[model samples]
Target: MTALSPLDKLMPRGYVRQMLCFPSTSAEVSHTLKTGLARVLADVPYLLAGIITSEDRKHVSLSECYQTLEDLYSEQDISDAIDYVVIKQHHFPPSSFAGPGIIPTDTQPPFPNPTPVFRTKLSLVKGGLILCVAVHHCTTDITGFGALLKLWASHCRTGASAAAGFDPAWLNRKALLERPDTSNRPTPASIPELLHVKGPDELTKIAALASQPSDPTTGVFFFPQKTLQALKHAVNKHIASWGNGGWVSSSDILTALLWSAVLSAESDPMSDRKGSNTIGFPVNFRSRFNPPLPPDYLGTAFIMTTATASRDDLISLSFHAGSSNDDEPLDSASISKLADIASIIRASLHSIDEERVRNVLLYLDGASGDHPPITLGPRHDGVSIVSWADQNIYGLDWGDIVGTCDAVRLPKLMYKRYPIVLPRVPANPAGDEGLEVIVSFDRQVFDKFRQSWPMRRFSTLRYYS
Candidate 1:
């Protein structure tokens, strides 16, 4: 049995699942879908199995490494249950897909002690098909998920033998664990510290915030290619002023814009207190380490990094709060702020060089396997932006059986404070390339946020009922 690595143990006990909806022209395609998915699983035996945990929660291994087809795939007919368009409208869905219940970590008898960590459910609806796959975070992250999708799509198009071409069994974390640690010692700043809520009061506050009395609403806003280009041009102009800002990617600018917007929408009194609003983003280290990991290093090879700026600085740089005139054009006061935001983000990400990543690996290498939670997301103090821009989610195709990808559905917002950024598929085949950001806030705060011409000028917004 392959053992779970130290990095795997640090993953929060849960699964990150995505619901991909497709337009189905035939109702008799279930068997074909099942066959394709089975082929997909057969090629990746590790994911078709279950996780075995020792008496304590410290150790985990893959057990029952080869299970029956039923263990991996489930099916249900939900044609008359819900509207498919509602799922389509959601740009950035919450993490909880099926329901609100958390996946049980400890063993529970009679119900399958060591359950499968990776699962696929095909929900057949009237006009469309919903393919839901849930894989524990300990098993893989979004990058790995993308790999599975590509392979599954290949299987659906061709057959199991073709799917084997994209199999990732050879890219496990074992190699990372076996590598020697020759990097310098890690300083406190080199490692990520936990910021999980402690005590009953904090939990209660988070629960209350999640379940707002007014029921927070989530909106998907689309940013067109022209707007993105304009923002990049502004950012580049500002970067030219700095002696050495390096190259700021599209994701850097997009994340900086969202971070600034979230800060502007904050209602907390402590938001302006010192470093009240810190922005954190996840850095993918697969290609950043000394001896860079292979492109197929499918495990969790990412680290979360947070950059703190004064609340005033963030708000001043925010699109909504920068210009304060009814007739002011979108570009009046956005250049410097956009530039500043991009600079801060670029600097934070640049700090995670080969040596820095090696230092973090070494630090975790010596830990007790149970390290503190890596903080990422909209915190009580600030907001976190997770960018999946590099992931080819829009390119998923299930052959001619399911036709083209109808829509990528994200879950609903469980927590109103935290938000997600999703790069959406273009409106038409020739429409502008763009991104969709899903955010939740109080009705009043969101109202103020949406009203800002600067925010509205760059994108079109749609709220979920």
Candidate 2:
């Protein structure tokens, strides 16, 4: 049995859904998939394992287990005429598609899966096939999911023998979590204090945020290679004027830009004078560790870093000054100045150094694993940004058998009521390196947001029904 880490024990129950769009159905797809599944079992056997939770629910472990291959990889057909382009042109609503492999189906009982992780179906449609891969979040984070697909896709392309070299990371023994000898040093940056949540009230507020309903919508925005370079150049030029300069990444600028747009669209000038606003980005810990966790570490190694400012500070001056109404037109120039916002984002992310990460591990180790390791978007006041700008999720290919995967989607399953931005894998070819920023907001807020400058500036926008 492989014991779960303290960090892993505190994660909420859920799975990550990755939908791949393969243009036009092919007879060879199923055969390629079956061969790939066999390779996965032999190469990454942990995918077939089950979670064993202690009776008191205090600890968790992975036990060697397996289910029938037929049960793990089932195929189904969608009689409807929905094609691949339509699925791409519009938002892939979590509810529209149903099959044996799709998760959270209406008929499944609560906590229904006997296995901790399983890939069950190949959804065949009229003009295309959708490959759905679902992995329990507790077992891995977003990167781990990408790694699994890369490995499987390799096996699919080169045959199972090519997968023999793949090895999964054993997460529990990472040096990042080892208690440091500090006989006389100040407490490393306190995770509890840095996160700012201490009591039952804060927990309740955070929990309540996820339960609130929103007229949520999904969107994909593409930033070509040249446009992205120009954006970073403009932002950095603007920042240099302030005499406070540092290396800023594309993720920082995009996250700041989205946060600024949400604030501009959602904040009410008349009543938001004293409101506090925040943007929280989940930083993947795989690279942050001193020695760094294995590239294939399948566990929840992430921490949310947030930047906060008053609503008045973030909104345009004209709106905050004395706008007669809440819906008055905002200044495009003022709204576009996001260098300062980007700096805050960059700093917040930079703060998560060796000490801060260790503090988080230490804090979770000492606390009761009764609630989510961290709370985001509580009380409808903050936004969460999860970046996959650096991950190669867009390159998973099954050779010529399945056709090339046009798009890879990460659906937002939790915190539906709150706005969350998922930056998707950029579209193919090196020059077309861009982002698909998916944002969720209330219907009213979304309406205002769509009219804002950011949405207007998008080269293309497809609002999901």
Candidate 3:
């Protein structure tokens, strides 16, 4: 009776929603998305020939340009909506998006909705792409997103010329949620194990974080490879601090090294006593629950904050070096300590209590409410709107980043969905297994945080160049 949805050909799919700023002044958000998607739809089977693009070392841009092209603000606002569409860009022909053939149970979570979730937006400047791609979270992860991104970027590099189906599907919350949980889950542990925990009563809000910088304004650029290498060197040197009992997690090591630099920048920026914070690793909470999430379901799996601690009394460390036999380094943890902290975080993971979700969601989701900043003083309120975003790297294949005979291969469904999913190259051990980083922050906080830690002089890893 109803005309089949065009994307039925691309079943078992995932979604990637990105907000991009265009060189032009056009304000139609959906138009930009359509411009990109439509370009890919053209003879993809022939043009790409299974070759995925890799945005390996590109630094996260602050903006493509400073001036706005020319879209009416009001009209842009009204049309600034998202559209979801299905396209078969993964595996080839006949059975385009057939059953992933894994276990369907993955689609089922303890929550009322069993479907996997996918949708995210990031705006660097006044105009960019608000990308939205739909995929079954049960089968795809950020790794897939990386690959998909390559495909999209490829198309963009080629041009935003439309093919047959240049238009996109409007993002329908109900339709996405209503989809069946047909994930072809392979392993049991791969599936989420539902764990429940009870925390303090109705979390009106979690404590806020704050830090003082010598400068009132500093440019915060993504770290470059040299900086990352220097950081690794510094941490390795610190590892020599193994006295009676020295320990730290990879997270702790990285945070300490990076934030220390941030502190240094603050000291130089001593224009006045300005306070700001730099938070990283908004870790996904997938494994935290019972029946871990399927490697596929591309939802907002987990979100955790790793704050700064340079204050004299607050100088603490939490790194976990691997076992004596392993190079992983001791994870800022001990046998008993791990069990205890796991239980604590696990408790935080399970407790759904809507009140808890609502309150904690503020900090977790980066809500820019009237709540004051954590360690800093008040003035943090007027920053701006509390919009949200994440550049989840876990979606990529970071584990087996080492050895490689050829190009990195990703699940077909994912390559067909998002704009920026790809594999790192020259192959390293990290690729054997992928390591993705999910960075979530409150936009308001980010603005304030940016002021304190100038990214202007900062850079990223060589891999990212």
lDDT of 3 by residue, 1-465 (tens): 111111111122223322222222234434444344445444231211111112441111111222111210112221233211111121011121122321122222232122233222222123221222333332223433443444444443345435222222211112222223412322222111121111233122222222212111111123334434443444444444544233333333334433433333323333443443323233443343334333322223333333322232111112222122322333433223322222322333344332222233223223233323222111211111111113332232211211112222222221111111122222234332221211223333323333332122222211110
Against the reference, the lDDT scores of all candidates come to: 0.63, 0.60, 0.27
Per-residue lDDT tens digits for candidate 2, residues 1-465, read 445565665555556666776775777788898787888777656666766656765566666766556656777677375565676556454433534444423112255434456564677777787777777666777777777777777888888554434754534534446545533434444445445443687678768875776546544455454555666777676666667556577667666656656777777746646766776667776777767787777667777667776565566532334444444443334434456666777887787776766666666655656644453212335466676665575655667887567666645432243333333445454444566665656566766666555445532454443
Instruction: Provide the lowest-lDDT 10-residue window in model 3.
Output: 83-92
- Show pairs that collide, candidate 2: none
Report the C-alpha displacement of residue 47, candidate 2, in angstroms. 2.0
lDDT assessment of candidate 3: 0.27
Error of 1 at 253 (Å): 1.9
Count clashes in each candidate, considering only residues at least 3 apart in sequence or on different chains.
Answer: 3, 0, 135
Q: Which ten residues in a row have the lowest lDDT in candidate 2?
A: 100-109
Please give me the total number of clashing residue pairs in predicted model 1: 3
The runs of at least 3 residues in candidate 1 whose Cα sits more than 4 Å from the true structure, single-residue gaps closed, are 52-61, 82-115, 160-164, 167-170, 180-214, 243-245, 268-276, 319-333, 369-382, 423-427, 430-432, 452-454
TM-score for predicted model 1 compared with the true structure? 0.81
Better of 2 and 3 by TM-score: 2
- Scanning candidate 1 in windows of ten residues, the lowest lDDT window is 100-109
**What number of backbone clashes does candidate 3 have, counting pairs of residues 3 or more apart or in separate chains?**
135
